[model samples]
Target: MARFTIGYRTVKTALGAAVSIFLAQLLQLDFFVSAGIITILCISITKRDSLKISGERIVACLIGLLYATLIFELLGYHAVSIAILFLLFIPSAVSVGAKKGIVTSAVLILHVYTVGEASAALWINELALLGIGIGVALIMNLYMPNAERDLLWDQVKVEDCFRTIWKEYAKYLKEGDSSWDGKEITTASTLLSDGKSKALRNIDNHYLRYDDYFYHYFAMREKQFDVLESILPFISTFGDTVIQGEKMAEFMEELSEAVSPGNTAGYFLIRLDELREEIKEMPLPQTREEFEVRSGLFYILHELEEYLTIKKMFKPDPKRTHNVSGKRLTRDLNKKGSKK
Candidate 1:
């Protein structure tokens, strides 16, 4: 029964409609039921979207009312007049970017036609109806419980998938031949895509436009995923595990464990610089196969540097930052060493 039950959004829409109808009646507006219908149309999954769309609907309704009045006054109410009104008003509404409100606009036009006249009183009543409906929808959508927490959970899921992928990369580097199924890469991609979509919806739940931290965070992760994908082909080029390869494997393992919010990439960046110097000091390759391996290792190192730089450039929300303390960092490093 719980699975079959209607959602909270549906309940909110129903409540909004009821309130709109009651308000319309209290004000003694004609076509009071139209207010309820408008309320239903205005209800959206998010408050910001609801407000935006309602404003458009109101504008479209007015345009529709104007066109209907002019057409009806010029050519008395008839089937031909209704057809002509649609032909003209639909294009006019589209031109003004109020195409979304066409259905509601049609309702207003038909209302005017049904009464055979467009009087001042009728106009006032319709305006009142639009106001009550849109206003009620705005009020109902103002509160969204657990929205932030839900977004955080999505963020954590995406990060966990990233950690798993990095761990697999580490194994591939250490063994030179890995049994990794590549499932985690697909999983991370899916999670990032889904998380981004949800964050965009969450952005629409607020009135202010630019404070959508999760949206930006997911976008950054999406960019990093491209770098991760590039590294996979380079990983498969390994002929044999050399000393530098083992060091990179260790670095990847450490990186996987450090994948948390507010974790700094400065330590990893310094370690990468040291690794680059060590490669520079190593003996030059003599054979063609040795040269290919050395060149591939340098390319892999360059990509790894880029991967860390992306994280270094990312700035997480200050309020949400759970800064990894020195004590926590020590503990995490110890745990990774113990696992190895």
Candidate 2:
């Protein structure tokens, strides 16, 4: 949320300039551009110099005008329009993703030129259009500016990870059902891993955007993410273990029940029940030895009833960070007793 306001503001400011410029041209006056620039100024002041969207707007306006001029009139090179287009666009997009870059600017410019018209009225109209578009963007987002687009995106990505991890936990539980089919588990695992992998991409983005403002913030997020990353793979393994263990338990129960009379086979239900309990209270290692032991045991126990019970009893809270020291995000959801 913090970052969103910043990024949105940047987009708003740029588009506002576009609209203001275009309107000024259309109106045969400079009213729109003046208004638009003022709007940008207001945003800049309000944002405490945190917003950097103006740079993009300036470049966008200049490039859009330039590209149109080149394609339609300025660059009357006889070789080929296609060649110029390629030369103009390829590097622009490659270097900076076309957005706020030279390539996309050229594309927008070309679009304007192709639309037809080049009189004084037309040029003014074009500028006005640009200014008006930019102005409108600014005005609408005036109250809710995003000075931190990238950072907010990072937060969004991190939140997604939390959802994915929970889903994975759920998937692992599903594996324990006697009638469980592997398809759902596999699909869930795929989604879980995919979400986790995607989460990493945001970490770097977050670090890049926020590290400058807050000391050690990026480092801490990175460490937390690292720990979380390790858990994903472990979770997958543990989930599989749970499926197998519960399946074994169920099989034993069925076998014991099927035994016609008192026989050695009838004790399978009792043994299965005992195994189920051990899995529930999975201990997080308090010491190095404990850590190693639990980590190892996790693989074997997710298949147990104890593991399933505790996992169900203790859902991870989005508002809370487990086993982390220092500042972290919190959840408003009900807190289950600690598993560790």
lDDT of 2 by residue, 269-293 (tens): 3564665466555444466644543
Number of the top-ranking candidate, with lDDT as the measure: 1
Provide the RMSD of all predictions against the true structure, rounded to 1 decimal. Answer: 5.5, 15.4
Cα lDDT tens digits for candidate 1, 51-149: 878888988999999998899999989999999999999999889889888998888788899899899988887888888888898888886654666
Stretches of candidate 2 off by over 4 Å are 1-57, 64-127, 138-340
lDDT of 2: 0.43
**Which candidate has the top score in TM-score?**
1
TM agreement with the true structure for every prediction = 0.88, 0.32
Compared with the true structure, model 2 gives a TM-score of 0.32
